[model samples]
Target: MEAHRIFFERPFDYKYAREYSGTLMTPTLWITAAYVILVFGTKAYMKDRKPFDLRRPLQLWNLGLALYSGAAFLIATKEILSTWFNKGLTATYTDINSFYEGTCGAWAYLFMISKYYELGDTAFLVLRKRPLLLMHWLHHLTTLNLVLAGYHYDTHLYSWLLWMNTFIHTLMYSYYLLASCGYRLPAGFAKKITTMQIIQFCIGLSILAHIGVLKLFTDREVHCNWRMWWGTVFMEILYLTLFSHFYYVSYIKDGGKKFVRDQNEKKQVKAQ
Candidate 1:
């Protein structure tokens, strides 16, 4: 029991550091292997059984998302308010490295560790036989890498990205929670959620690019925290591209057109 407590409770300790790094590789590989096996195994094992009912699991997922988003929001708000009002914006803004390492360091480490917990999201998708898009898995896998790299470098600029992501996730996960509870939000709101994600990526990319430029041209001896900067920029670009494709396919392509046509047909039938 003590060993279990140490393993599960104190995951952030350096003695267990390799476990954190191993998370970047192990979860994705295990998830992928499990998915492939299940895809094939399900065909043989439950050919006649009814399809899996995902409602309960989805609700659990929604609850998890709510908790994660709430924690993220609280962390971001605490950092922002303390930095902005108490310490002055310029000082807080300029010295992000110090802020993260000193004030919010432990929380950031906790959040980073939580990424491993989130691997369960993909596990549910596989269990439900949901199509595992490359973007989905890539996002999960690379995010683990990003968090690990960010901690290693202790990058200051990452705070802004974390803050913005926390805000967006509050909405994103709330939407998921509502949907899981069988509440149908407006179609416009769904579109807005996608738009918010896109905007997050755009803002994140711009910030990293700005820092990169500053490193290039300025006389100021800017700290080149390459791990955080490059990892974030690369991931943001990938997210932007992947989400743009998903949006186009979901809202503009042949599938989207067919969906609209079907809705119109149903409406006409009801009118009759």
Candidate 2:
């Protein structure tokens, strides 16, 4: 409880964020660097070795992520709506304290922190020697940076984007939970998950685009943190293109073809 008070209960202060002075930013940088080094180093080290059986661990990891994402989604939704109903929809995003200082604030902070744990999904693949996609880690790294930047800036965009992202993660991690256990989820479910992600990015991009237009069209300057605003928009575009390509190659052109295996093993290896 004391720890929570110190870490979670405290609201973000833009004064502290003036120069990236926070618990999350430096650690995010160091960890991401380490993640890159270890990914390559471990791959070379494991080239000649047999793949370790990580079925049970994978199951546990995915299940844990699924549960956490679901909880975060619910908490953020309830608090945001409460703020909207009690305060007003217009102020819900515009007012920093209304969006960031309370239960809703705690969950928003948690949502940023949760991206670090999601990085573990890539780690598990590295350890298990699964075929890794470069976009996976790049997306993770860029997201961590953007989320921290967005949160530190205390922009309305982060609040909306975080809520949407939490919902997507709930579905994504649940799908991973089933896949980790080797259960054959409905065919093409992975494709659908990617499609959902694409849609979220599209919506997110639109929101950011509108912000840009406001910055341009309005005579009075819009009070946005330009640092994160442009970074977020760039990343959204990059991911939108990358995910669309991944979907095309994985689902459309390939016709959603998955790995093949024997009947019993099929349930254990190929799903998502």
Q: In angstroms, how far off is 64's CA in candidate 2?
A: 1.6
Residue pairs with backbone overlap in model 2: 182-267
* lDDT for each residue of candidate 2 in 1-272, tens digit (9 for 90 to 100): 13344353246533343234256678879988998898889888888997788888888887887787788788778867886888765444445465565566666767777887788877777777877887798898888878876777677777777777878888887887776665667765666788889998998887777777767776534446677778888999999998998877666664545322223355455543
Report how far off residue 168 is in candidate 2 (Å). 1.3
Per-residue lDDT over 21-140 for candidate 1, one digit per residue giving the tens place of the 0 to 100 score: 444455555654665575457545545555466777788886776677677668767877777787665434345544454335555665666666666676666665545677777777
| Model 1: residue 30 alpha-carbon error in angstroms | 7.7
Q: Which stretches of candidate 2 lie over 4 Å from their true place?
A: 1-5, 8-23, 83-96, 219-223, 254-272
lDDT for 59 in candidate 1 is 83
Give the worst 10-residue stretch by lDDT in candidate 1: 1-10
List RMSD in Å for every model shown: 5.4, 3.9
